[model samples]
Target: MRRFSRFVCIDWSGAVGEHPPGLALAMIGQAGAPELIAPKKRWSRQAVLEWLHGLADAREDILVGLDLSLGFPFIDRGSFFPQWDGSPDSARSLWECIDRLCADDPHLAATSFLRHPEARRHFRHAKGDTGDLFEGSIGRLREVERHQRVSKQANSWSCFNLVGAGQVGKSSLTGMRMMHRLEKRIPVWPFDPIPDSGPVIIEIYTSMAARAAGLPANTSKIRDLATLERALCVFEADTPAQLDRVDDHATDALLTVAWMRQASTVPALWTPQLLTPEIAQTEGWTFGVL
Candidate 1:
């Protein structure tokens, strides 16, 4: 298998509108600093999905990472949500369920599914709005997530967690919808076999990449070029010029893409020892977790 020639990191958003919060993208090649890919208008979850399709259309041999949970906790509980018959058996089925339920949702938002009377029961929602079956944020981690914590690499929140600033429920749900649509077009790592020579997408947690760049867990965000350049240096990447607008979203995408370029060289990430075929089909592994 040949190494990827290009890399891209997307700071995804699950916000419910045409314009979403914290959505950004950065890309890089074999050598050089990452560059942000932005549209004239603010980014929407839909636009980002479209951009990925564009990459596939161009036949780009790239490794792409999206900052979101690709699959929920399944192996730990025998199903995505224990005791729930509707709970999907595989990651692809889960994506289909979310997409079908949220098909009418605007901006690819998972609003309808999030509000589903039965479906909402698995999530920890807003203040005083936790579901009946909902466990706390730290309770329902996937197998790889548990290993990630054990390795002391990064702390992970359940995809069912929907409250507070760290909540990734919205992003994960909406992203699943995108993944459902992306289906046979682009191969998502683990769930689909990597194509002999094309782009492959994987789940990524930017915090892990930041830690690889020598940043602390609680203070991993880089909101300026100076800090971003320093982080890039950890990967021995070229430093980009200062940009007019700089935020953690832009910085996360920039730094993580560089990190992916460096991290892909490791032999273990592609075949994590703990990642069995069943787990990959159920709860996909994060690229940098190993």
Candidate 2:
């Protein structure tokens, strides 16, 4: 029998009116099942680090998916700031967090935030023959749009829609930090568009759906929430599992607030994909199992 692996998908977006990236986290594993977690937003770097620390504590084998640039773009490594305290409207704390973790972990020893690399090479979206976000069904396809073809650009340029004029650096730094953590083996990168033998895609929209109905984070009444959470374990043939202590009420409330607040502008921002058994030997994925 083939062994199963679990994955975590972390879809990151910058916080509103702040340079810090907003994150969407998903835990996928055991035959392609996915478990969605509560989303969080904070202005403090310490808060970001603490959140990651908590995740690390919860599941050490989790593969974290990040959607930010993970390297220093225009400066030397030594001159970059260290020991970020999250004070005075600066990204120092965030940078420092990445620096320390990468420094301590061998997998993350590749480099620091001083220099960044491209993540797309490791992942690509499914595009149809006409070259659109592939719908996979081929029948009288529509013409391609001007923006359909993706090209490489600076992280700052890519995230210009979120970070604004001066925050590209933050995007790059955050990406570097995320990769560093993954490289250190503390976390794994599972955001690749292609499924991996070790990870699976995360169903982030379910959480939003749960929040829409005002269901409890851990309730028996919300059938959707229960199904979604259970879907996280469907891929596994073994490990029947135990009931997780989920606060369904809280989850519903939070998702409701986020949607009402117009967080839907970027629905894809909340969706994440995990590494799965299929991805290890192949590059395609289907939604039938996990």
Candidate 3:
């Protein structure tokens, strides 16, 4: 496994506003516990992009885990949207297309992209407003998500469903925009081969990292300082100096960072049995699902 100077986790949001409270960032250096970065301000997608660009500029050796899907399901139906001709064939292309369509959107908001003709046909909107090409009940699961289900880990929400608390549609699309913009500076795992050095981003299900700390699926959230310490102890990580638990995002990112450090050393995690070259190029894999 390649050693990293830091491990970071970003709990992203797809909300319409300039800065979303749901967006959170946390990181741990080579020698200390995980700490939230800029915990005071409501983070805008653009701010997160600037932060990542700074890290890339510094040539930092870090493994960043973003809590959002990198790409929609492509392999299951041979293309992300089989019926539509505009569907991107690969993850990088998908990000590029999303970024292009949402270029005018402020704070990297993807609502504009959702208004696109093809997008409206593939995603389920408000009640009774599902797109014609939207797949089954929960929509199509990416290959990694299917394997996640088989392994009894965190099963991801379909990027096709744009409604409900469980749906990650908006968040994933917005994050895809960030990925597209960051790719030139920072490499995204699977979509871009694991780089020899510098920062690399990977899709992560917070539940998977929480599970690594011995938390069950039903109680994956770590909201209080005590619970946060308990999870960190599982990795023998030091307790964070800051103890603000205003929301679950802080602790979730903290636990994820500690867990990511441990998971990064596992050889099998880097190469899951179910991950294929096609899947890597199309629907990217989550970091700790294996």
TM-score against truth, every candidate: 0.97, 0.32, 0.96
Off by over 4 Å in 1: none
Candidate 1 lands at a TM-score of 0.97
Candidate 3 yields a Cα-based lDDT of: 0.85
Candidate 3 backbone collisions, by pair: none
Query: For residues 162-191, could you state the per-residue lDDT of candidate 1 as single tens digits?
Result: 887888888999899998887668888888
Total clashing pairs in model 3:
0
**Candidate 2 residue-wise lDDT, 90-195, digit = tens:** 1233344555644643322223422222211211112421222112232111011111112111111321112233233344444445433433324221223322
Q: Which predicted model would earn the best lDDT?
A: 1
Candidate 2: residue 85 lDDT (0-100):
29
lDDT of each: 0.86, 0.32, 0.85
* CA deviation > 4 Å runs, candidate 3: none
Ranking by lDDT: 1, 3, 2
Q: In candidate 2, where is summed lDDT lowest over 10 consecutive residues?
A: 139-148
Give the better candidate number (1 or 2) by TM-score: 1
